[model samples]
Target: MNQQYEEKLLNLIDRMVETASDDELFAGGYLRGHISLSAANCEMCGKTSVDAMNNAVENSLKETQSELNPADQLIVNAMWEKLRQEAYNK
Candidate 1:
């Protein structure tokens, strides 16, 4: 289940490469790392739920929140939410 969710998240990001604006592209790329890492962590910890994966990603983002400026942070946050919703709906 975690792997499926991770793939959905990654597919959403991958689909953005062709038409995403510069900011969206940047946000997607930035989020890919967090999502991938969180998924791996979930796997290592034997966590299979999508919620666990999402929480791990959220925590990872908070941990590195200082890396982005306020505007960039907003962009990434918005993109993350969008991706999460889209992935969940699929």
Candidate 2:
């Protein structure tokens, strides 16, 4: 992610942190790690577009899906989708 996307993501997370439930907070935090890692990876690979950032996030989430239980996965995926929409659909 570039500066703009990073700012958007941080703003989203800030709002989430302020209003989320305990479970949601956990989910958001977990997703944040994936998003950050994906952004860093994208930067390293010279892919600065928002599309690349989105793809990196999706790939990271998909690759880790099996690590979460069904309920947890559902929460995480929901949060991820929300972030995706806010970050990319704006």
Best by lDDT: 1
TM-score of 2: 0.87
Error of 1 at 68 (Å): 0.3
The estimated TM-scores of all candidates read 0.98, 0.87
Worst 10 residues of 1 by lDDT: 9-18
List clashing residue pairs in candidate 1. Answer: none
Best by the TM-score measure? 1
User: Per-residue CA lDDT of candidate 2, range 1-90, in tens?
Assistant: 375786687679878787799888988889888878988898889999988888888899889889999999899888877887887766
In model 1, how large is the Cα lDDT of residue 17?
94
CA shift at 73, candidate 1, in angstroms? Answer: 0.3
Local accuracy of candidate 1 as per-residue lDDT tens digits, 4-90: 999999999999899999999999999999999999999999999989999999999999999999999999999999999999999
